[model samples]
Target: MLPSASRMRRGEEFADAIRRGRRAGRPMLVAHLKTREADVPPLVGFVVSKAVGGAVVRNRVRRRLRHLMRTRLTAIPRGSLLVVRANPPAASARSEHLATELDVVLDRLLRGRRSESRTLTDGRS
Candidate 1:
């Protein structure tokens, strides 16, 4: 499980972030990330809608995503807010498939961030 303070729980705030954040997509998930002025580590928000399945299924998906982040997201930079949404296909995905997909998305997001930082530092668009 991710630490309490590292979780994003506010609905309106999440909506705002999703609207403004940079996006990275994969087969099983979509990630929205915003760079914040806060001093804390990344605050992640996970979205698993009812369309994924019944109550049990949604919770399972949420749990799996959280676990993936707790350990894997360490590579992500600080002061970032990340929201990951589950698509309908996630209802049928096995844990291994979901895990691999999350890893791929994170990798892509981090790569984008690095390139963006270099661009900013070098005065390139």
Candidate 2:
């Protein structure tokens, strides 16, 4: 289970991350990431809509994602907001596959952020 302090609980928080964050999509899920300057712990939220399945299936997917994120919390930067929105395919995806895709997406997002910061600091237009 994700710690309460690290879980995103408000609508505005989710909206901000989804609207302003960098996003990456996979067959199973889409991830949004926004880095902030505050010194708080990273916050994570999940979106599992009816398109994914009924309550049971949606809850299962959410639980799996929470478990996956628990192990990956350290990899996310402090003060960052991450939202993982599940695709319909995620309803049937294996745990390992979800973990793999989550890792790949996160690495891609973090790498992109790093390069973007480098470009801004490199003094080149």
Candidate 3:
């Protein structure tokens, strides 16, 4: 389980991330990440809708994704929020498949952040 501070608990938080964040897509999921100014650690939320599966399959997928995110929590930068929405394919995906997809999306997101920060710094002087 993720620590309380690391879990996004409020609907507004999730909405904000989805509304203002950059997005990365995978075969099984879509990730939206928004960087914040606060000093708090990153917060994460997941959406596994009924389209993904019945209760049992959805729960299983959510559990797998939760564990995957927990292990990679350190990779999340401070003062950012992440929301992951699972697609129907995710209900049938193996853990390895989910992990690989997650890695690809996260890498893209992090790379985008780095480039944006570089552009800001380069324009400054």
Error of 2 at 59 (Å): 0.3
User: Mind giving the per-residue lDDT tens digits that candidate 2 earns over 1-125?
Assistant: 99988999999999999999999888898999999998899999999999999999999999999999998999888999999999999999989999999998999899999999999999765
Point out the higher-scoring one by TM-score: 2 or 3: 2
Over 6-98, each residue of candidate 1 has an lDDT whose tens digit, in order, gives 898888768866998888888779988887777678888999988889999899889988988899767766778889999878888988898
Candidate 3 is scored at a TM of: 0.95
Descending-TM-score candidate ranking: 2, 3, 1
- Show where candidate 3 strays beyond 4 Å: none
Which candidate should be chosen as best, given lDDT against the real structure? 2
lDDT of 3 by residue, 31-52 (tens): 9999988889899999999999
Report the lDDT of model 3 for residue 8. Answer: 91
Clashing pairs in 2: none
TM-score of each: 0.92, 0.97, 0.95
